[model samples]
Target: MSASGAKTNLHEFVVQENEQVAEGLWRMRCNTALAAELAPGQFVQVSVPADASHILRIPLSFARADARSGELDIVYAVVGEGTRRLSAMAVGQASTMVGPCGNGWWLPQDQGRALLVAGGVGLPPIFACASMLAQTGVGFDVVVGAQTASRHCVGYVDELRSMGIHEGCDCARKVVLTTDDGTLGMRGFVTQAMENLLAEHTYAQVYACGPNPMMAGVAKLSMSKDIACEVSLERMMGCGFGACSCCNVALVDGTQALCCTDGPVFDARRVQWQTR
Candidate 1:
């Protein structure tokens, strides 16, 4: 949150695993010391090697970091030319990256039970969030939705158990899932699942990440339930260090904030959601 210096720390990363997790989602693991500084909801900006073929670096949100092992894991969806090249990176090859950039989520201790909702690639950051919530000793419910179940992994549940969340049966059921094709659990949107949770429990706060549309739905649901919520944002950037003005964002309050430096995580009420 310091004003004005390059927050991005440049490093070289070797591709460990770049496998397709679902239809359009890819789970990528990289080797870097940046794992120590990275937190849930933060991201790394990676340069797709310098060449005529690809010069731009794509911004990817960090799902989790293994500080002891010096490894960083990210989940990204193929969306543009840069991502296409990145998705095809072979194991052991190196990629240049700069980060652990952007603001992360804040877990208030007084906030009772937590509710987490995610869509597609956005589910990555929330993985670490579960650990953070566990550290507070508060019970949390996480719900993720996708187009299919081939990408499903309940690693979050195991993580919470590791952190000592003793809510046995209920916590196990906390992970409500949905797929558009009915491949796994519920056959609907993430919002529908969130709505159901909201109806059952008055969440202390809500956290979400996903496409703008999904985030918008979460914002509306949070407002309806009178729950404070925060979201991790994604934006196009020329430089992840805040040197370039490419990632500027206008919040709902008419104040301009830098997505790279000010936040990738913002309170749901602060974002300019309706127009985006």
Candidate 2:
């Protein structure tokens, strides 16, 4: 794939509403003309105008994209100037973005039982993939972890209300929700939840997107269990497209992979996870 360039109406979207889904998590839906074209595991790079303080682009993942409604959704947390500026923007303002960049998180055709695991802000990309998985008439399970129940993203069910778009997936089913603080759901790290599930059921393939520790832990478990796994990476970016080379990371095979080009999603076994 080549560098993604800015194009007119290229899924460049306007903020419809930015609501707090969790304490730091904000669900920002974009008003786009091409929401329908985006699939699961795919992400969009958004340009964030920093608070009069600086200039930078915030690379974000597509949590959910509604093609029929011309709406795209992204769930993010306030980490710095770029996101803060995004939070302050009023509805109707447009964000300059380039996407469905990188590789998407799609399940293999013969996956007997697929597992989609997400933690913290990493949950967004899984949401997009879940929608796509549902379309394939395939059965899959989802696992989400956070510090507390309140930290969970929008689509996840919270006892009385359903947060996601699809309420009834085939008999595939789900068993997730782990918290470190016992504030809500299971009181423990998400890995604990993942381990429990893996012990009970043998998954054909597993996919994950989250913090390095979380992703690494899952990869280790999957490796030991001989389960196929893939992970979506998050990195600081200047341009959402590949032009800036800001999202580049070295793969385990001594090869380079641009998070914007080669993948934001890579097989868990091949990622070289280290803080730079």
Clash counts for all predictions: 0, 4
Off by over 4 Å in 1: 1-7, 151-173
How many collisions between residues are there in candidate 1?
A: 0
- TM-score for each predicted model, relative to the true structure: 0.87, 0.86
Model 2: residue 61 alpha-carbon error in angstroms: 0.7
State the lDDT at 124 in candidate 1. Answer: 79
lDDT of 2 by residue, 15-122 (tens): 899877788988887788656656567666577654545555566777767767988888889987777777887788876776656667756757487788888888
lDDT of 1 at 253: 78
Q: TM-score for model 2?
A: 0.86
lDDT of 1 by residue, 61-124 (tens): 7777888998888877888877888888889999788776787788754568888888888887
Q: How far is candidate 2 from the true structure (C-alpha RMSD, Å)?
A: 3.5
Clashing residue pairs for model 1 = none
Output the worst ten-in-a-row residue range by lDDT, candidate 2: 1-10
lDDT of 2: 0.73
lDDT at 151, model 1: 62
